[model samples]
Every structure is written in C-alpha cells, then in structure tokens.
Target: MELGVIDLVGGGGAMVAVNDSTRTLRRTRSIQLDHVWRALETGAWVTAGFRSATPWLSSITGESPSASSVTLRLAERIQQMPQVKATFADGVLAESALRQLTDLWSFDIAGEFARDERMLLGWALKFASGDLTMLLATWLLHNDPDAADKTAQEQFESRELHLSSLLDSMGRLDALLDPEGFNLVRAAIRHLS
Candidate 1:
C-alpha cells in the first residue's frame, strides 16, 4: 500500500515531502526562466502575436503582469551571468533574494560581480536583504570611490517641481528633490506654514 500526501501529515516522511516539494518548485522556476530566456532570444512572443514578452508571459503563465515582469528581468539578468544562473537553478537563494541580487547587477559593476560572484552569493545566503544591499554598496565604493558624489550630482540634475490644479479645486504639488534641496524646501515650508 502506497502512502498518500494526506497520510504523510503525521508520518515520519512529512519533512521529506515538504523538502521535496520546495525543491520541485525551485526546479520548475529554473526551467521556466530558461524557457523565458529562449523565448526572448527567439522572439517566440512576437510569433505568437504579442508586442512584448511580459504580457505574453503573463497571459501564458497566468501570473500577474508585475510578477511576470520581475521574472523576465531576472531571467535576462541571470542569462548574462552564467554562474548566478547556476546558483539560482540549484535553489541556493530564494526568489526575493535572487531578485535583489540580480537588481544589483549593472554594466558598471558586471566585471567586478563576475569576479566575486561566489563570495557575494555566499553573502546573499547569510545576510538579510538590507545588509546585503549595504555590503554591495560598500563593495561598490571600494571599486568606485567617486560613486557617491556621482549619484548626488545625478540626483541634483534630475530634480523637478510641478504644480497643477485638480478637478475639485485642489492644488497638486509634485516634486523630486536632492537631499539639500529637500531640506531647504522643508525648512521654508516650516517657516511659512
């Protein structure tokens, strides 16, 4: 007599079943990622009459658009980094952590990441997401000492303020400010109001 899943609830093999289920989910995700990459490379979505892969993936997989978009982005990122893809395939990191790791990859730091991929992956396993982010920032500072200044300058350059009248006679204010500008505006509002 074979045991069913219901029978495994209070049985000794429950943990094994749970672990196997988790691994299966990870393996399925890995396979889906591979297929997504292949579809992008081969323009399968276009052939299927979709404008882009995100909608196609969402429709086909019954996942939300945002989730599919994230998966597509991660697939693209991991495709460029073979070692990271392998780690993900092996279920070394959970999806949230892997998303964080892939989000950190950029052309500016690709070479450095490739060189230290194993160490960083180990960190991903050990550190919380926020700690991993800080560690990566520190790593970036070591590689590029001017990164902080460059980022500040970029923020300053991109600042904007927009004022509009809403339909119900309310004013709408939209602003994007650098740290210094934000402080100045906050102080002015406090003084005036």
Candidate 2:
C-alpha cells in the first residue's frame, strides 16, 4: 500500500497529502485545533476505504484497518489518571469533561503532575472550570516573574492544545490507515521554508 506524506514546515506547520482509491486529498494548514479537526475528518474518510469488503480494494487499504479499537485504547489511556478514572468509573465524566481532561493531558506540565497523583487529581478538577491554563500561568509567574509572562503562557497553552489535538487526530488516522503502528511521513518543502 502507498502511504501518505506529512511534511513539516520550517515555521512549525504541517502539510499532509493522503491518497485514497478514488482521489487524493492534500491539505496545507497551520498546526492548530481546527486544522487537526479537518485532518481527522479527512483521515476518517480515507480510512473508510478499508470498510469495503471487496478483496481487490483491500490491497491498497493497508493492514489492520479499524479505528474503533484505537479510539477505545485512547479512552482507556485517559482513564488511567486517578481523577479521570474515578469520575469515569462513577459515571460523572461526560463526553465534554472527558474531552477537556484529555486535552489537558497534552500540556508538558501534565507529565510533571503525573508524578504526584493527588496534584494531578486536583488539577483535573480545576480543568472542569477552564482555569487550568490560568492557574498554571499563575504558578509559573510566581516561580519566575521575569520569564513567565501572561502572553507567553497563553501562547504556550495554545501550542499545547494544538499539539494535543494534532496527536489525537493522528492517532485516529493511524488506527485506520496503519494499524500495525504509526507511520508518520516526513518531507521537506522548500517553498514552505
């Protein structure tokens, strides 16, 4: 099977080219939340090629073609956090809450908090109010007043969320397109530079 290519630009953006049996879809966009959503949609459709049971079409569809299992795995990973686990186990974690919590996991601070489960749980609760980023900024400001400015923190949060969304989309796409493992395409476009 011919795999797609995802080229990363010098400016930290990505351009993806995916080919399905019918047509080829190429997208050039910034690494943002909306762009990731579009990638997910496109990947879902391209991956749908596997849904066809016809043997001839199966060759180009790649192996291990199913996104449902991968989605479940993602949900399970999110549930590993103590707070998320409890909320999910108790049925208190709705789709929106789950999404927010998962999104929060994309931040670098999440790894730091992971070492202390109690703190992570507290932050998870704070995530519900949409103040997690603000609180993190406040902490950073307290630690390094000169460096952790509000604007920088905001940009950091935005980048974190964008990356999180991108990875989430890529996971979905990989589940459908390359089930064995993630096959990230790398390319260099001089024009983008």
- Maximum-TM-score candidate: 1
Indicate the TM-score of model 1. Answer: 0.66
lDDT of 2 by residue, 87-187 (tens): 54443333344454454443445454465546645564447445765655455454445543544454444321111134446532232222112223222
Write down the RMSD of candidate 2 (Cα, Å).
Answer: 19.0
State the lDDT at 183 in candidate 1. Answer: 100
lDDT of 2: 0.40
Clashing pairs in 1: none
Clashing pairs in 2: none
Give the runs in model 1 whose Cα sits over 4 Å from its true position: 1-15, 144-193
Model 2: CA > 4 A from native: 1-80, 106-110, 126-128, 136-193
User: Per-candidate TM vs. native?
Assistant: 0.66, 0.30
Candidate 1 lDDT, 140-185, residue by residue in tens = 7887677688778767985766566869999866676899999999
Which lDDT values do the candidates have, in the order given?
0.78, 0.40
